[model samples]
Target: MSGTERGGGSTVDAVRAWRGLAETSVLLDGFHALKHALRFGARVPVALTSDKAAVLALAEDLAPDVTRPLETLLAETDEATLRALVPRLHPTSVAALAVRPSRAAQLETLARLPRTAPVVVLDEPRNLGNAGAVIRLAAGFGATGVVTTGTLDPWHPTVVRGGAGLHFATAVERVDADRLPPGPLFALDAEGEDIRALKLPDDAVLAFGSERSGLSEGLRARAEHLVSLPMRPQVSSYNLATSVGMTLFHWASTSGRPPGTGA
Candidate 1:
């Protein structure tokens, strides 16, 4: 089960049903969530849990002024009504609640952003867990945004589950390659040029290959360059999410920018 962080402490006064994403978010990565929530300077308005002790502890950790007690936590139970509440809280602090369709389309809307910005595009990867993990890592690495082409769905349950609370913190767009902003595109490939040797631009699209098949022909043709991770002969390549994270980290390190500072 998972849940989102809903804004408005006043909303907490009334015991409205909370969606699962928020409930599960509390458990996704305790240390990471706590750190991110604090890093972004978020006030945890409610800590709804079945157990009183856990609520108290979370309140103490997050800040006593904002914590709201609830009768139950949504993640532990499979209640349909509670689950349905997710879409209703669209654009709320709970990042996973409902993604605006306009926001979804903007991922490929080139006019809104610069061509050289650090963008991540995943193509038909098919695995929500990988996508969600990539979202978290993308935020950690200071990506300007995330865009998915083909059939990859960012709102899929598994991906949302993997993202924890990270989905709320960053801009994620889903679109096709044609919709992507104009720029120097680089696809991650095992046989491509060494990433370490390439003169990576401060702003460019880093297209991660599909988890199973690597880059699609459409993406391959669209990319201006191909990059590869360094590895011993035994290991063919890195995990889809791992490769994206490592590449983003390398870009950040070489650019002399701190992690998570989006250009």
Candidate 2:
């Protein structure tokens, strides 16, 4: 597992010969790539590098297990060769699947989940950190998955780091508003009905909008119910993630729903 460098296409061949989805994904060239891989806890199956010294040095320091020495990993390479190398590269046991979805559609995906102990969706959310942190939080709260609309790539290096390893375990689907699965949709809005007083349905799709605009007109219209979290009159509004977390917690406490149970 230490600084052992195997030479030639054999190392590349060894990586390419791997059968299952890479238990780990390793990125070459930049720090962001490395950061994302590390954040997801993906095993560094092999290191592809132009700088042999640098590659060996990196292997010595960071990834002791994966050290496949290859020339094709250098900066200048063709797609055919890269494609050939990809299968061989092993991803970690828990792979971080990434997606970049549009604003409206991501919202729609959120609008589709079952209300009973389901996933969280953020529609047309602009903040990258909020989107990433929310995905991470959703995983932490034991939500089934996360849907994002109008935001950065959840698997983007920065977002992955923000997720703090939560992204790998969660199903993040990027979809359009029109494609949302049919269900009881609810929106969290200040003007909505009191969450405590309202009778929450057995199954629901809870959708939250951005901080400034709140839920969109179309989203507001689609919701079967509009729910609001009780708060101090002096407080203006909760952060998007905070609001969603509150609603999730509220449902968890009130619904008597078991974890991973669906509507």
Candidate 3:
């Protein structure tokens, strides 16, 4: 873990393997992204680093839990090699390629009954950064997973970057409004019930709309209950990410034990 002359294969072999898998694999763009992904059980086939010693040191100091795997998984390479692998180099200069989770597996998890925490729904979200942020928040609060009903791929590179590789922590997938799993659908809207008054159930399907249009008519129709965040006065709406944060925070606080407290 100290030098630039470690890891399984030759630099050329490693680079070739990376290039071959680059299009299909999930790119862990930085040290933290790689760290989180590894901690959460991402199958990292190849990892590249310009500075192994420093990266391991950072891991040891900040995330000691992942230090050993980082030492094992990281393949030291030249700056040019690392740069060529990724579009823009992160400040930490560490990158890796991890296998994406099986969509069928994620769908099965989502479809399971007696869910312990809410599944956050992003109805036709437009922004990648917002989707990533919401996914990260869902992971933080121990929500079951994030389901997006729209054209946006929740696992897109930009969204994954924003999520900081925490997608491995929870189920993430896309489905139509009608295909959403069985649950009491509670859609978030401006003119709905005040969130403070209701106790968000552990098994709720909490849905939030896009930043631009709010909840869509189809989503609204699918919703069994429509809830709202408290607004002061003239403010039209909150940013999609922040709105999700507030709603999940409400769920966690009123949840009595935790977001995913077991029976």
For each candidate, the alpha-carbon lDDT, in order, equals 0.60, 0.55, 0.87
- Indicate whether candidate 1 or candidate 3 has the larger TM-score: 3
TM-scores for all predictions: 0.70, 0.58, 0.95
lDDT of 1 by residue, 20-47 (tens): 3355322222323433443343344333
Q: Between prediction 1 and prediction 2, which has the larger TM-score? A: 1
Any runs in candidate 2 off by more than 4 Å, and if so which?
1-116, 199-202, 257-263
lDDT of 1: 0.60
All candidates: CA RMSD (Å): 6.9, 9.5, 3.0
* Candidate 2 C-alpha lDDT tens digits along 115-201: 445556677777777877787677665565676656545555455555655664455665565555445678888888999886545
Cα lDDT, model 3, residue 122:
95
Candidate 1: list runs displaced more than 4 Å.
1-48, 62-111, 115-117
TM-score of 2: 0.58
Which of 1 and 3 is the better model by lDDT?
Answer: 3
